[model samples]
Target: MRVAYNEQMNALSKILGEMAGLAGSAMERATQSLLQADLSLAESVITEYDQIAALSHQAEERAFALLALQAPVAGDLRSVVSGIQIVADVDRMGALALHVAKIARRRHPNHALPEEVNGYFAEMGRIAVALGAAAQEVLISRDPERALRLREEDEAMDDLHRHLFTVLMDRNWSHGVAAAVDVTLLGRFYERFADHAVEVGRRVVFLVTGTLPSDEDHEIDLAHGR
Candidate 1:
């Protein structure tokens, strides 16, 4: 019975990894479409959203089934619960990517961002992609330390987002209101995508260390002589 239970856990972990990869790839493609005004690539990201959603549903189903059949205890139980939360976070990440793609499509043949601010969006996309990659690595390695370190990446995304607003608010800004709206939405999509990746990392830490992120932070503060 124990052997069977472990096998099921392994299978669920594999599914979660695949889901993370899909979300990351979707975001990367979406970023390309947004910055380059590539309607075809945007369409591809939008089209693939259903697959990401389906994987989340499958992960939830497997987790519940494991609970019913295995009645997992301690670490196993944490794994099942965390698996559910991780799937939710990963699924949301994919949806955010789809939003980015749709914005690109909405403004097809015309760049969504002004030339002066284009570099800001590019950097935001880079940070978001890096966070997604880190989320996948933390999940697979179950490294609590790596998971905790993702918070810094999230801060970088936040900084980019704030910087974007400064550009938009400049009195000399020439882009019309419609363009500003598009940039606002695009910045939000990237920021939220990074937020979800950080959430996934926290879930991984909980799964491995059985300690919530807040509690882990408290411990770190104590160790640092704070």
Candidate 2:
């Protein structure tokens, strides 16, 4: 029974790792579609999102089954609970990527981002993808230190998000209101994507240490225009 329980727990980890990979790839492709105005790639990101959702469901089922069958106690119970929370974070990551893809699709035949701010979105995409990969590593390795390191990369994402607003609010800005709205929403999507990755790392820290970070040590303020 113990061996069976261990195997099931390992399987749950594997599913979560897969979900993280899919979510990260979706964001990467969605970024490409957004920058290049590639409808086909955007459509693919939209379509493939179902896979991440499916895996989230699968991971949840496995976690609940472990809880029911094993009645995991102490650290084992923490692992199961943290796995459930991580699933939610990863699912949100995928959903955020889907939003990005839809925006790209909606603005097809024309770039959603104005030429001046394209570099900002490009760098945002790079940071988001890197954070996702780091979160995945932390999940698989269950390393609290590596999990904590996600916050450092997330700081870069926040800087990019703030820079986006600086450009939009410039008095000399030439893009119309509609373009500003698109950039604002796109910046939020990437910023939220990075937030979810950080949340995943936080959950990993809980799974390993059985304690969450202090509120002060947690994610940056997500308030709009902050």
- State which candidate has the highest lDDT: 2
- The residue ranges of model 1 lying beyond 4 angstroms of the native Cα positions read 215-226
Please write out the lDDT profile of model 1 over residues 1-226, one tens digit for every residue.
7998889988888888888888889999998998899999999999999999998899999999999999999998999999988899899999999999999998899988788888988898888888888888887888899998888778878777777777877777899899988988888888888888888888888988888787232111111211
The RMSD (Cα, Å) of candidate 2 is: 1.6
Provide the lowest-lDDT 10-residue window in model 2: 217-226
**For each candidate, what TM-score against the reference?**
0.93, 0.96
**Candidate 2 per-residue C-alpha lDDT over 114-169 given as tens digits, one digit per residue, 9 for 90 to 100:** 99998998899998889888888888899999998898788898887777787888
Model 2 TM-score on a 0 to 1 scale: 0.96
Look at candidate 1 and give me any clashing residue pairs.
none
Per-residue lDDT of 103 in model 2: 97
Residue pairs clashing, model 2: none
> Highest TM-score among the candidates is held by which one?
2
Q: Clash totals for all models, in order?
A: 0, 0
For all predictions, the C-alpha RMSD in Å is: 5.5, 1.6
